[model samples]
Target: MTDHESAGTPPGTEPAPAADGSPAGPAGRFLARIALGARHLAAGLRHILTTGHQSDEEIRRTLVLRQLEAHDAVRDTAREELDAVRRRITRLELAGAEEGWTPEQRQQVRMLREERRRREAAARDMGRVPFVPVQPTADQIRRARHKGSTVRLLGLLAFLAALSWLLVQRPALLAPAALAALIWLWWSGGHPPVLAQRPVPDRLLARPELDPDAAPAALTAAPGQDDDQDQDTDLRHVTTADEATARIAAALAKRKVHVRSVAPAVRTAYGWQADLTLREGTVADVVAVLRRLDTDFRVGTGRTLAEGSTDDSAIVTLRVLTSDPFANPPAPPVRPPLSCSILDPVSDIVSLDGEPTPLYLAGTSVLAVAVMGGGKSSLVRDLADYVTACRDAVAVDIDPTGRGLGPLRRAALRTAYTPEAAEAELRRLLAEARRRTADLGETEDVWQVTPTTPAIVAFLDEYAQLTPEGKGLAIEVLRIARKARISLVVCTQDATADVMGDAVADVFPIRVLMPCRKADIGVTLWPSAVSEGWTAHHLTPGDDHAPHDAGRCFIWAPGHKRPILRYVPHIAPHDALQRAQERLDAGLPTLTATDGPQAAQAAAQPIVAVMLDAFAAAGAEELTVAELLDALAAVDPGHWTQWDTRPDRLAMGGREIKRALKDAGLPPVPTVRSKLPGRPSAYRLQDLKSALDETG
Candidate 1:
């Protein structure tokens, strides 16, 4: 056969020779078929790797078992393309060797190795750095643990030693010296509890610490650097009070506040006190600088009071808290279990000096003044919950608009939404207050909770929204604050003279000044606050800054020098609802129009007429009040039960029966004697008939 014809028979297999001349062998044919099968297997593997049909997991499994083995590299393009598959398989095998033979184990080992390497590198870097000790704080330096006084005592002992030596030289002087020493000791012991004499104030000192030239780089660093550790480290060399003052001065200057000089830092009852003499600036400029210290500097600032200077420049006194007062604000006070007294633990005061001040909601009324969404309503709701929880407290809410107190209106015994309704409720409450006062009489000035004397708390929200008549009623209610045991909590958005009249404002000795629209309004609530530079205008509205100052406000009670920072804790709405539901389920009825005095008057008239007719039919003009009550009970047991019985009563007493009689419109038991001389006072049947006839 020709060479071309022979080449046409494919590579591994050949067509069998038909006739004579062509050679054919069984062993050759078998070897050719084997070669063909091997070639097909290689093609399948190439296709798999090129197409990426098999997953990585499958590829790994096949490579590990040697089911699909890698081939040698080649220079030709076609062979080189196949060689990439081998290389990929080899790389995967190497990776498997480095990792544990299992995928999950491999991942864990890789993470641990990475972590170990990172830790070792960190350690190497840390070893190369120098050690720097933290500097002692200013408070640490000033707190002597009575060491200075102890040193003074030692000096006194030394003087006494010298005196003893002199007496030893003259034996006769011992008796007189001993007596003098005893008298001195007695005098020292009898000294009043007054503070030790302090040295001249830092403001009065002309020390080099007060020299602005000493710190030419005053306020060189930006306010943001105050929080940097590097900044604190740079201050380690600040060994004297002068250096601290210079650092503060530098911080103020960086915020564009020109400072003439700074006084040496001095310890005071409030905190560190320093006077900063401004370079011809107003109080507004000083306030602007203080704002930067708190905002950009990230430092807790206290009151910054501006005083007039003789040189025409203002002297601003700075107070920096040693620690952040707001760092760990106390949680809102929890409601105590139901008790007879009207006292409650509501909020905690985070005083300017980082001290915790507890607020006890007792007999005093509270006035919360702020703009809308300033957390005033939250405070009111919390107190309302406490009032509703107390068994003796009568929670009455008055909101003419009904928006503020709507959610918790169910908790109130009497909720008045309209102006007319609110006025009526206020009048009734005033009457109740007068009645309570009369019950206390001169024998007891303070109200004590009995079944008869319940605490009446009128929680008035948005007092500025009250109508003319409602405002008048509110003024009347406030007048009975201490005298009639009536407490008023008046909340207003604008606590101006027009909104909250002086008489209404004076009723609430305890005031919470929330963030208002103007500082003057805060001053209206706390008159003395202007002098101390205390204002709530900086507090952010709503719960946006809740973690910092949501319920936070400046609180002024009767005995505080200035309004203090207090957090009026929030009560969960669900909790309030649950408490209210509990109260309602216990048979505490709502005080609606039907439950008012007019309703009682209408209801009692018919009953009175029936009883009077019954007495007249019995032909008795005069009968004892007890006998009349017995005749009524026999006629209508249900009406008698309504008037005479109280559910869930704490004790067995005649108070319920007496209350029933008064509620039925029966007059108080007469003191006039009966004709029988020894009998009880009598009710005239003829008068009852005449009263029934007049109604007809």
Candidate 2:
């Protein structure tokens, strides 16, 4: 036998004597044991209350079941033992009453009778184990609170009614009586009532072992349930942590990397996250294995996900895509007009795993590169729509082929269809940037664009076709990206470094790589892009030989971990035109001839000469200032800002021409009286001709 059985002591019951053979202080030893036991008891209670599934509720059910079983076991045992003692007592009584009994027989019968009586008294003296439940149900708690509140309210009402009667019957005695009662009540409740204390149990009370036959009815379920559970089908294949770990191990083993162990998997909002330690592999090796896993597992790339450590461990967060996102796309986001800055997400919302794709266009320049029919122009068109609708931003599109900015023409301040026109527009924008710098004070780095100081966004499609002049203009424009507040969105079919040289390419921090014919284009645009999983070469184009139609591409924007897939929205032509017209009708500022050099030339011409030419062209003898300004604006909108149509203000667009009559050697603008009241400014064509002939 072990030492414990020989000592007649149960395990963990008491500490043994010291080597010196002196008994340890029993009080100190008992107290120490009690403290340790109390700590463990408290910890167990806390775990029961918080750790298990449906912890509080499950704990309640488990405790109730255990209590019922214990009560039944103890009661049944006591009843059976008592019954046996009673039978023995009856036999002793019958023997004592018999005739011709010997003295020894009588003595033996008395001893048996004494023993039976002692056993009966002991059984009666054993106290009962009362059952007290904990954690009342929600309904029980609610009902208790309601009942207590109702009782208090009824008592208060009764006291109030009694006080009213007393006040009417004996007003003099009521105040004193009420004061004395309040004082008594306050004094009684001020000190907490003392509770009688009982000695804590020296040893923890454990429930008696329950008999299987006395188990609670609820514990004895229908026999077929177990068989049903065993036969139930689990379609997920991977249900437990062990199963998921096994799948990951198998995937890694295929790449010749053995997984030593998998950490406890966590269920994230997207999918499961697990840390994997390899027996012999580097982080790069792990990443390569994950890339292979993508073919079968569909996990994100290393740069975007799959973080690794130097200790040959990696954390791969993966989610299996059950269906294609494109096939069942979400409703496209509403297109809001651009405000002070140009940041807006112009695409249907899409997320990686659970992280939504971020597309912010403000405070940055962009470059879009793709082969022909690769949705490059479609992206530009979407951008142009945003730039046009902005109150303080001007949309200037330079599509040398004339087809790119069709829907944007009505909204744009200027649209160029020739290399010379685009070049001239770029030069004018560069000049505006300088002017803005002077206006804002050279010390200020960023242009605080406002109604008066508007931002200029120049969208140049087919950038590869730019002449030397346009290229020079592009370089200058790109140089003032952040400081001057000039944002250029340059797109091209050719993604070669030669087409967008180092100087230009370096400024475009937000590079969009749409589908391209060659994989090398991604490397050309960004050298490290290939390693970052910029796989534009693998993108499948849409049917009818169109590349994604709109928005689909890989975007490498600022602050992203790596390149992410996105689709640019395709705004219908009618919708774009309607929005632009709404802006015009709202009297918001539109693009003017001053936005580009070609339009600025018209402004440089003598205002009076332009006025005379307008009347000559119209073949009119007389015209109003409004008519002349309208004619000039229609002919060259780049040079002329739209006239303010506010009823409270005088016309400002034609004010300059009205003042320029004297400079052209003509009479001052004369006022023509209106039928209602005020005289409006008007000019005569014949007088302007006579004055021009005299000046000549």
Error of 1 at 645 (Å): 42
- Candidate 1, residues 1-696, lDDT tens digits: the string is 422122222443554553663535765444444444444433433343242343333322323223111211112333344334334433443444333247764455455444534553554454344222232334432333234345555776798799879988999998997777555434432232221223434532332222222232122333344453233312223445766676666666556566677789765443455788766445455654455665433444333333334355467766654443455555545544344356544434556555655455555777888776788777788777767667666778887777645466786776777665566566566555554555564778766753344566788887777766567656665666565556888888887643554234555667777777553443355333443445577665765544444566777675553445556656667766776777666644222212234333434554553344334334466776455554444444455435445542212222433454456555543334468756655566545444333443
lDDT of 2 by residue, 347-439 (tens): 333544434565555446778877766777567776776666666777777877776577657777667777656665665666666545555
Residue 620 of model 2, lDDT score: 63
* Colliding residue pairs in candidate 2: 413-591, 551-567, 551-568, 592-638, 593-637, 593-638, 593-639, 594-638
TM-score for each predicted model, relative to the true structure: 0.46, 0.46
The positional error of residue 209 in candidate 1, measured at the CA in angstroms, is 23
Model 2 stretches astray by more than 4 angstroms: 1-245, 257-322, 326-330, 335-349, 353-363, 517-525, 545-550, 591-696
TM-score of model 1 relative to the true fold?
Answer: 0.46
